[model samples]
Target: MIRVLVVEFTRPDAAAVALGRFLRDEGVEVVHAGPVDTAEQILRTAEQEDPDAVVVLGAEPPSLPGFRVFTTAAEAAEWASGGRSHTADAPSDRAR
Candidate 1:
């Protein structure tokens, strides 16, 4: 199964929670990490989870090499569903 790490910089809002559920329903393993303070913390969590992809919400996107950061739950879900590719790196930040 595809493993996705969902990182929230603040308390998870409805959208974040719903994203987790959506990923679960898609048969993807969702690892939720958050309310963390810094980009470093986010990177550490990503490293620990070692997910195939990382979904970041409510914060500036960390410049972590090799990890594609999706700023919205819908974008993340679409990517996770094979509807998007990490190679399309332009416009890296999705509107929250």
Candidate 2:
């Protein structure tokens, strides 16, 4: 099974919770790193968890070498499932 470390840096963490649920539904192992204040903290946690990928919700993605950073759970799911074509069910992209 694919393992993912989810880092939520925003306040109101609802998006992260939703992403965790979505990933779990897709059969991915979700590791909640909780809300962090900096990218350094995320990197440190990633080192410990060593997940296949890292998903960041409600914040800009951090730069983690060897692990891909996905802004949306759907995109991460697709990547974890071997780059399958996405459908309309994908959550809307966050506005820039």
Task: Assess every candidate by TM-score.
Answer: 0.78, 0.72
Candidate 1 runs further than 4 Å off? 83-96
On the 0 to 100 scale, the lDDT of residue 35 in model 2 is 85
The best candidate by TM-score is: 1
TM-score, cand. 2 vs. native: 0.72
> Alpha carbon lDDT of residue 26, candidate 2?
76
Give all candidates' CA lDDT scores. Answer: 0.76, 0.72
lDDT of 1 by residue, 1-96 (tens): 567888887555567788999999888789988567788888888878767788888866778787867788988888777745443454323311
> What is model 2's C-alpha RMSD?
9.5
What's model 2's overall lDDT?
0.72
lDDT of 2 by residue, 1-96 (tens): 567888886544677787788778877778999888888888899888867678887677667776668877667766766733222244213211
